[model samples]
Structure formats: structure tokens, C-alpha cells
Target: MDLTGKVAIVTGSGQGLGLAYARELARRGAAVVVNDINADTANAAVAAITAEGGKAHAVTGAVGSTEVAQALVDGAVETFGRLDILVTNAGMLRDKVVWKMTDEDFDQVLNVHMRGTFTCVRAAAIRMREQGEGGRIICIGSPAGQRGNFGQTNYSGAKAGILGMVRTWAMELQRANITVNAVVPVAATAMTETVPFLKPYVEAMHNGEQLPSFARRELGFGGPEDAAGIVAFLAGDAAAEVTGQAVGVGGDRLALWSHPDMTTTAYHDGGWDAEAIEQEWPTTFADHLESVGEKLPEEASAQ
Candidate 1:
């Protein structure tokens, strides 16, 4: 994990998971650029890194803006001479069900999580290609994107979009040896505060079985450090060949995501006939329910 002579930029690095990633990367010798919306937090992180004998600078700005995201990349190269790693860790949450969600809430999450990630990755990838050197692009994602959550339609959409972007960008940038990967971190952080109801669900998702309310307290929840290690690995040379992948990080719950089974083909030939399926699958709906059993509860599917 020695990143000596390498320059890294971590968005939202002023606190929480992003700060952990920046600090650990700097400790391993990467000259870090800590970006945050709060000037004081960003400055504090940078100062701490410097005090520990690491190279770092603070950039305070909203990551959701294209200008600020680009500035972070450009600032790294301008101050440190090159950009080697770009971590899109900046994010905010607006919790609401689809019916309860507002236009503003949806737009805000999409802007920060999806557009902000694209902005930094686009800027850094172009620079890396121009420099004729391989680079690492790491994005922070969440489990809600993989498995739909009850009240996070906006956040899920944005994070799912990130997974798609990472896959495509990996193919596009592979020629230049720049890898794009994402981490579905279930670690407790600021973002989790907005989804208090989902905390139990997340615990069940990690623990693999529903726990009694009294025993739930004993279920392990990960911290920022747990996520930072995986991010560091992805940002380092050790993971050079790993690209276009989404990895989940939870204590005792590290595994590739499980995709929704798509065996129910509604097409006969080259096209789908909605009318035909409506007639043919009169019993199909019941069969599907029996097939999935308790996983697809009647009340849950009503939504």
C-alpha cells in the first residue's frame, strides 16, 4: 500500500469515510488532496496529515458542482505535479419514499452522488490518459443501490447509475490502463444518519438472518476504517488488473453482489408481446410467488 511519489484526490475527505481513506492513503505515502464542502473540516484534515509527516492540501467546495469537481483534479496535478488516484467519496442523502419524495430531494441526491462522481472521474481520466500513465478511479457506492431500499429511491438510483458508469468507463479506459471500480460500503457514516429505519435492514442484510430486537444490538456494524482499507487496496497498484467491479465491504459480509434472477423471459422471438404475457402468465404470477416463497411477501410486493 505504499503510494510514495503518487498523488491522490479524495472528495468529501473532510470527515467520515472519505477522511479515513485520505488519512490512510496519505499515511501510506500518497500526497493527498482533501476536498470538502466545509472549509474548516477540510483544513483540519489537511493539517492533521501534514502534522503526521504526510503531504496534503485542503480544497473546500461543493462536490456536486462541475467546477469544483474539476478544480479538485486540476489542483492535485497543479500542486503535486500529477494525479494518480481519484476517489469519488463525496455524497449526501435525502430520504423519502417515491410518493413522499420531492423533486428537489431527488435532484439533490442525483447531483451530488451521480453527477459529482462523473465530474471527477471524467477530469481525472483525461489527465491520466494525457500523462500516458495508468490511473485508479474509485467510487463509493451503497447496498441500497444493489438491493432496492424502501425509502431511498433517489439515492438508490444515483448509486445504481454509478455502478453502470463504472462498468462502461472501465471498458473505455482499459486501453489507457486506467481502472474504474466501486465499493458498496455498508460502514456506518454520516450518510446512514438519514436512513435510521434502514439501519436494521442493513444489519439483517449483513447478518443473514433477522435478529431479535434485543439481540440486534450485538450485531456488528462496521466503521469508516473498515471501508477505507478496501478503498486503499483499489487505489493501489495491487489491484491494477481489477476493473469494472463493484465490491461490498461489511464486517463478515464481503461478497460480490447478487443480481436479480432474470429467468422469466417474456419474449418469444426478437420482441416482447405484453398482451401475450398477460394471457400466458395468468398462473405465472402465482408460480413466481410460490417460487420465491417468503422472500416476496404480499405486502412488500404491493409497493
Candidate 2:
């Protein structure tokens, strides 16, 4: 996918998966605007791209801010001449079960991941529409959002909300040819390293040691580059028809995710009362009910 002369803004490109995405886009001949809240990290990314003879500019600011989002779009147009792709990867985690999660924790995560993505996409879409060329808007999602995770209500909620935006925007912007999609990446980034169960393996990988078979089996080959390829693919023209979907990327695996839909339904000529519904509930839907975190008993036993 040659992105020669394309301009892209990748938020939170200072490190980890975001950094990998920025580097890959730049490598593909895209002039990148690397946005990070941290100035040092942003500068380092910009320097690395320049060292490799790729064009890039650093924009440091909080992604959740409307002003910052607008500035990022403006910077790309001012520096690169026009904007063509936007990858909203800026996010933070505040893991806590619903009861223990504070307002601040929930708000911060939502603002950065959901609200920030909306702000950036809205800003970029305006320019893309006016420029008269379609654009690609890719938002970062998480497995935690698809299937709920313990102690991650805030993070999961925000990530799931982002997917919703991806679907909505994909349809809303289709007329302008702007495609919006979500990518759920599983990699050993700083974010995953925070999980106690994955920490040892992630640290070992960082030290160049081979991961245990179980870790390898569960998380696949763990690295940010593993996820970057998919993001780059979606940002290119080849994926113009691949909007409104969630794609999973990890190791050498790439999978398409199914959207929510009605699997089964019960109908009554007249709406049944609570008591009447309770009487028919078992025959109506119990057999099809699914467990939260696992397959049906028959499938689980087979596995």
C-alpha cells in the first residue's frame, strides 16, 4: 500500500503500539503528524522518522481537548499540505471493578479514548471532506471492550464506545468516502505489562528471552509491530471497502469480528405481563442463553 504524499495524524505515537503505527505509516511514505501528550516522546518519534528520511512533525497536547484535536488537523494540513488518514490511538487505563472505580478514573478513560477519538475524527473529517478526497479513520479498540475484563469497567466502557463511533461514522461519512473502522490489538505493550499475570512474560520478552509456551499460546507473539501492520493496511486505499467493522490483530493472526445482532426472540400477540413472561421464560430463551466469559458447556468440555 503506497501512501506516498498522504498525510496522517497518529495520536499517542510517543510509544508502544501508537509509536509502531506512526513508524510504519512514515515508512510507507506518509508524512506523519505524531501527536503525544508528552513532548519528549513526541520529539523522539519525530526524530526517528526524520533519521530514516521520512517526513514527520511533532504535536504535543492532550488528545481529549477540542483545541488540541483541531491543532493536530491544522498542523497536518499546514505541514504536509493535506490530511488523508487519522489513527486515534491515544488512551489511558484506570482499572477498577465497578464498585471501586472512581468518577475521576471513569471520566479520564472515557475522555481520552472515546471523546478524544470523536474530537480528532470530527476535526479530520472536515478537512478530508473539504479537500474532496476520502480519508481513513482508524480507532484503537481492546479485547476487554469486546468481552468484559475483570477490574476494567472504565477502560472497557470507553473502548466499546469507540467501536460504536466507528460504526456510526462509517455510515455517516460513507457519502464523503471516509471510512471508519476499529482495530482491537493484543500485544505486549506498556499497557499490557501492567497486568500482573502478563507482566513476567512481557518483561522477559523485553529482555530478549523466549516466552513460555503457555504465554505464547495465549497471547500469541507479543510485540507492537505485530499490530502495526493491520493499522497500516486499514489506513491505505486498499481497505476502502472495509469500514464499519472491528478487526483483531495479534502475532500472525488477523480476524474479523461480528457485530451485535438478535440471535433469537420471543413474540407474543399481546405483551405479556411480568408473571406471564416469567412462566414462559425458560422455554422461550433459556436454552440459547450464553455465559459471560465462556462457551457453552458442550463446547467448553470439548475444548
Candidate 3:
């Protein structure tokens, strides 16, 4: 439960879930590099951690570029002596359906979420490998990525790509003793507040009203702090053996998500032609068809 002497970096730590992760890591005795694009919030985060008797430094800048990523790693190493944990939690959304999504919307989300994660994790990996002391790389994923969501063409695609990279990095970095995993968190944040169906629940949380059991238990929605523990846990030695996992957390709920796999398969000699596929689809594949889009109960939505 303690992370004494560990040096860590948390991206997008100015506010919301990223800030929660930074605070939790610091509380556990890790020296943290708080990174954000905003100067005020970044400085505030560093100050808050210092007031709590934790060590922190602010490195303000947008992520996603090689230079920024390298600068963050350099900042952590220069300030704390060594780096042990890296949380690639910086992200943004440009929600729009496929037809309505402009190039700007799609490119921007991918640049910040997927590419940002890539550059940051790549820089951390290089450093951690050189240190040969082992390290933790925690990436952020979303339920929308697991299952498609309406008006989130850009977001869902980027998140899904991040998970894909996590699995690959888990294998690639295993020899270096670096563990990689994803935390699929659901919380009341600025991002979730923008969702049309979740506005009331977000407002309720801000107003200090109790959320319904469904929101807590089923939707796994709660304050950002509720989801912060998993990040802290994954960053510590206790979770050293855990890697290549998508662990979900929120209020009243914690669960493991299965990786994507082929559910059903059939073999046909020389591969089936169009007519042959049509003939066998009903018996061989039709029964295994899968549906997309986020599925929530009517009760959860109506709330």
C-alpha cells in the first residue's frame, strides 16, 4: 500500500479523474510530476499535494508530441531521481456520429488520446528499460471503447486503439519487467457530464444528492476519487504480477473485462463461395452474430 521512493507522472492532472490519480499516488508517498495543459490547475495540483505533505511538481503542456512526452519524463527524472510509474490519463472528446464527424474532430481526438498515449508511454518505456529497475505503465480506457457509443466516433476509436496498444506493450515490455495495464473508469467528470443521458446524475452528484442504486451499482458512476484507488493499486508492487488487464472501477462496482476473441468459427474446404456462405451462414454463423453500441437498462437511462 506504500509507494515510498517511487517517482511517478500523471498526465492531465490539472483536474477531474487525472487529478484524483495524481493525489492518490502522492498520498501513497510517491513523488509525482503533475502534467496539464493549463498553468493554473497544474500549479494548483502541485500546491495541493504539497499541502498534504506529499511531493509534487507541475509540468504544464499539451501531450501527444514527442517533445512534450520526453520533457515530462525528463521532468520526473530530474526532480525525483528516478521514474517508477507513468499514468497516461490525459484525454479529450470530440463527440459526433460518423457522418457528422469532421476531419478536425476525428484527428484531434486521436491525436490527444491515442497518439498522446503512444508518445508518453514510448518515452517512459525507454527510460524504464534503461533504469532496469522495472516500472508501471497505466493507460486509460473507456466503456465507450469497449462497446460503441452514439456520437462518440472519435472517442471510442481512440480508446479502443489505446487498449490494443496496452496489450502489445504488455508483451513488448515484459522482458524489461515493465507492466502495462488499462483502467476503465466511470465517474462524474466534465467528460461524463456532457453526455445527454447522464446530465441529471452528474448534476445530482454536484448538488450533494444521493445517486440512485442503479447509477452506483449498474452504471458504475460516482465521484472521481472512487475510481482513483484502482490506479494507485495498479501503480504499486502489490499489482506487480497484474498486467495486460482492463480493470473497471466506480462506485459500488469493480469488474474485469475480457479481451476480444472470436466467439464462433466454422471451416469450409477451399473456403466457401458467396453461394456456399449464404447456404451455411444461418446454421454456422447467424446464431453467433454480435450487437454493438453501449447497452444500458431502460431504468438506468430513464433516471
Candidate 4:
């Protein structure tokens, strides 16, 4: 895929997965706007790209607010002359079980992942529609979001909300040719490298030690750059019609996650009364109940 002459914006691009995405898009010839809360990392990301003969500019800001979102879109247009791609990769994590979680904890994650996604997407969609050209909006997702993870009430909720919006926006923006999709990536990034059980694996990867084959093949785990190519593909012409999809990618594996759909159906003329449903529930629904939680190999923590 090629992105020559395209101007793109990648939020939270100062480091980790976002940094990988920014570098990938720029490598494919897009003029990138690298956004992050930290000015140092943002500038450094820009430098890294430009040093490789790719075009990039830094826009430093946290992404949840409308003002910051607008500035990001504006940065792309004013700096590079047009906006064609947007990768909503900025996020923060506050892990705690539901009972131990605070209102601040819940809201912080929501504001960054879900609300930030909405506002940035709204801003980008408006600009893209105005330009009368199709654009790409790639929102990030997680296994936690798809299959509820332990101690990630806020994160799961926020990411699930992103995929939900992607589906809705896909339908809404179809006429404009703007493709909106979500990427569910599992990689060794800043957000995940700290997990107690995975710390060893993360450290090993960093030390250039080869991990077990299962880690990359089954767990779909690896460095952030391994998942970066999918972002570049989704942002290019080849994926113009590929919208509302939630694709998973990591080391040695790529997958397409199924959208939520009913796996079983039952009929009730008017509606079954509580007693009748209780009597039939086990036979009708119990056998079909889907299990939840991230499907991890026995070696990792549930989260």
C-alpha cells in the first residue's frame, strides 16, 4: 500500500504503538502529524521520521478535549495542506477491580479512549466530508474490549465503545467514502509491558532474546511495530471499502474478529413469564452461553 501525498494525524504517537504507526505511515510516504501529551517524545518522533526522509510534524496535547482534537486536525491541514488519515492511538490505563475502582479512574480511561475517540473522529469526519474526498479513521481496540478482561472495567468499556462507534460511523460515513475501522492489537507496548506476569516476556523481548513460538503464534504477542503494518494498509487505497471491521494483528498472526451477533434464538409468542423462563432457561440458554474474559494461554495473568 502507498500513501504518497496524503496528510495523516496519529494521536498518542509520541511512543509505543502510536509511535510505530506514525513511523509506518510516514515510511509509506504520508505527511504525518504526530500527536502526544509529551512534547519531548512528540518532537523526537518527528525527528525520527524526518531523519529517514519521511515528512512529519509534532502536535503536543492530550486528546480527549474538543479543542485539542480540533487543533490536531487543523495541524494536519495547515502543516501538510490536507487530511486523509487519522489513527486514534492515544490512551491511558488505570487498572483496578470494579469495587476498588474510583470515579476518577473510570472517567479518566473513558475520557481518553472512548470520548477522545469520539471527539477526534467527529473533527476528522467533518474535515474529510468538507474536502469531498474519502478518508481513513483507524481506532484502536483491545482483547479486553472484545472479551472482558479482569481489572479492566474502565478500559474494556471504553474500547468496546470505540468498536460500537466504528460500526455506527461506518454506516453514517459510507456515502462519503470515509472508511472507519478498529484495530485490536496485542503487543508489547508501554501500556501492557508492565503486567506482572508479562514483565519477564517484555524484558526478554527488549533484551533481544527469542521468546517461545507460542507467544507470537498463539498469544499474538510481540513488539508494537509488528502490528503497525495493518494500520498502514487500512490507511491506504486498497482498504477504501474496508470499513466497520475489527481486525486483530500481532507477531506471526492476523485475525478478523467477529462483530457481536446472536448465536442462539428462541421464540415466545407474547413473552414467557418468569416461572416458564426459569423452567426452560437451562435447556434453552445455558448450553449456548458464551464464555467471557481474554482467551489467554494458562501462562499469563487473566488481565
Best by TM-score: 3
Tens digits of per-residue lDDT, candidate 1, 101-209, equal 9999999999999999998888999899998989999998877777667778898899889998998999999999999999888666667644544365455646666
Worst 10 residues of 4 by lDDT: 294-303
Worst 10 residues of 3 by lDDT: 294-303
Across 155-199, the per-residue lDDT of candidate 3 in tens digits comes to 999999999999999999998999999999999998999887778
lDDT of each: 0.81, 0.87, 0.94, 0.93
Please provide, for model 2 over 1-303, each residue's C-alpha lDDT reduced to its tens digit, 9 standing for 90 to 100: 889989999999999999899999999999999988989989999999899989999999989989999999999988989999999999898888899989999999999998999999999999999998899999999888887778988888888889988999999999999999999998898788876556776888889997665554445546888889988899997898989999988766678878988887877778889987898889978788754531223422342
* TM-score for candidate 1, residues paired by index: 0.84
Candidate 1, residue 136: CA error in Å? Answer: 0.2
Ranking by lDDT: 3, 4, 2, 1
1-303: candidate 4 lDDT, tens digit per residue: 889999999999999999999999999999999999999989999999999999999999999999999999999999999999999999999999999999999999999999999999999999999999889999999988999988999999999999999999999999999999999998998898867767877898999998778788878888999999999999999998899999999888999999999998777888889987888889889999899986567766553
Each model's backbone clash number: 0, 0, 0, 0
- TM-score between model 2 and native: 0.93
Looking at model 2, the pairs that clash are: none
The alpha-carbon lDDT assigned to residue 16 of candidate 3 equals 96
TM-score of each: 0.84, 0.93, 0.98, 0.97
Candidate 2 least-lDDT 10 residues: 294-303
The local lDDT score (0 to 100) that residue 272 gets in candidate 2 is 86
